[model samples]
Target: MAARPVSGAGAIRVGIGGWTFEPWRGTFYPDKWPHKRELEYASRQLTAIEVNGTYYSGFKPETFAGWAKVAPDDFVFALKASRFCTNRKVLADAGESIARFTGQGIVELGDKLGPILWQFMATKKFDAVDFAAFLKLLPASQDGVRLRHAVQVRHESFAVPEFVALCRDAGVAIVYAQSDDYPAIADISGDLVYARLETAVEDEPAGYSPVELDRWADAARVWAAGGQPDGLASVSDPAPVMPRDTFVFMISGAKVRNPAAAQALIARL
Candidate 1:
């Protein structure tokens, strides 16, 4: 629950989910303006954050670098691949876009780019054949690339052994989400974990709820205490999972109320 860097022998493996703005609003001023102050605040405790805005366009490299400069050498940043890539399922074109993000956006952030998250929508179901084909298309397979690769699926239909095997075989970390599709949590297990919180109740999807963020933060803590080579059952079991070193990303900013979501999770921590 402490806002500190969660490190292991390999990657720094920390949360890149930065959805809040106020706490960092003044932190990063007119000087570094949004860059230095932002990173300085983030690096104060949290190790990494998900680049939520990159999914949209108009990203600049210099800004990323300013953030990298502020953060310490060991600090890490998880860069989310654009929606054109993950949401649209344009794996082929996604490669080029991803390359651009890495070469441009990431380079600016420098060494802070910790992992590359390929998050998909819940409306998208799992087509094992299509997905398997898509996974094979990543320009550089998980092994070939230096960055960690993780996938988040919204539909429970995708929670099949074949899919899990495919992700495991591909070295992709499958997400264990806390939405209505909540799949036993035992079903999804891998080296890395990406967790998102959506807490907007004023108005939202048919059954959307923002209050769940509190429960999730508690659950994330339980799941983030272990490392890899850790079997599915072991990671799923609450016994070991309770106090494991697993890295559950604190992703937010899915909407305007994301600030509310971030505050909720941060409060729990």
Candidate 2:
């Protein structure tokens, strides 16, 4: 099962946060499926995956290469940047931590590597100067592999037009988080759109209802075709009409049904 590519527009990738989850074992995966083969199976089902483990731990080049070999050629892995790089008071001083995280064999993923997500703490406030400096620290490429960066700011202070402008200037995507606790910024600030849909419920078999899934599918297409959706909150006007790759991940909420939600959205697309 290779990833399905959309024609005429930028690719719209649908996926879950990560492949490994105990709850997914009979729900999303086969009852007798081997635990070690979960990535191989999940990669075939979803077009992309948000790798959360990299946020907490570092892996060897071989570990990353091994993952690349298992997944489909068109399948991509969006890695969460290390907490050490974004969890500090002075974000401008995190160049060393950022370098360390980027240099940690991530280029081994090669073309399979998607965007690197830099998620800030909920308590962190928006600082224009510091944030701008921090964004400038991100490398344009690593070992010949071009890298895409997206920031997930949890605080409401980041909901302003200034923040959107900063990300636009830096060419880094602003993650549109659909969590009640996080500020949802729908403004298009980068070349790509990264969305984390967190409003899933255990009552629904697919985490989200069919109507919601349909809505998301429509939104994904709009984003891929370079236009903002009508309903989401946006601090700025719609971005210019141009194709942009879109990454939509079913995350948080009823975590158990996320895989189903991702698959459902993929099916709709």
Candidate 3:
């Protein structure tokens, strides 16, 4: 987030959910800047972004390629898996939907591609057998690129050892979504860590309070170094010293100022 160099393979990426919000034009971007150049501009400012468009609607291969061409080499874009795949009534029945979504040209992003987020609705209670079957559906690669998956389960039923073990065994990270509306499970289930901070307020200049941003930065560093933060809710016990790359996103809540919040957190890192 702060443009800091990552030693070895471990890195810390800080960013917002998306780059096309109109409210960011005057605040996060130049008021007179062309809308078409928003991605290019935002890529320069934030280390990463969670591409939310793919969740609502699919994009063409050329569209993904176009995005890759505009951003910096180090910039990463985490794609949110299609809602059609995760919003279904039967989690185990998502194979075809999942395959269709993954086959929809996401590999065109190449090196710019980060983790793919699979967010389930809050009402989708955790069913160990069904959830395990769904986890098995996630592929490890697309074309020649290795794929990373992060699951954001909103139901309170997901806070359990069985859920954590399923994710850990599958090597899928469990998204550490920070907000009052969702269950807070900060378990480190895979090789990478993902966090979505949604507490940014409208009036707060940087979205979150300065102290809060500082705390987030601290926690991010710990995760990047392959350690979990103390005091946060966690379901798994990560090895005491194994380090991993981490991604932290400032999303939702005070959406208008999310970019600013990311920049603020980046500054601390």
Model number with the top TM-score: 2
Q: Tens-digit lDDT track for model 2 on 1-269?
A: 32234566788898998888999999999999999999999999999999999999989999999999999888999999999999999999999999999999999998899999999999999999999999999999988889999999989888898998889889999999999776798999789999999989999999999999999999998888888899899988677777889999999999999999999999988
lDDT for 102 (candidate 3): 86
Please provide, for model 1 over 93-179, each residue's C-alpha lDDT reduced to its tens digit, 9 standing for 90 to 100.
455655665555565654556556777886877788778766665544232335667777777677567777777667566655444
Question: Would you list the clashing residue pairs of candidate 3?
Answer: 1-266, 226-243
Please give, for residues 66-127, the per-residue lDDT of candidate 3 as tens digits. Answer: 99999988889999999999998889999998988888898998989999999999889999
Q: Candidate 2, overall lDDT? A: 0.92
Scanning candidate 1 in windows of ten residues, the lowest lDDT window is 233-242
Against the true structure, what is each candidate's TM-score? 0.64, 0.97, 0.96
lDDT of 1 at 102: 52
- What candidate 3 gets wrong by more than 4 Å, as runs, is 1-9
Q: Taking the candidates one at a time, how many backbone clashes does each contain?
A: 18, 0, 2
**TM-score for model 2?**
0.97
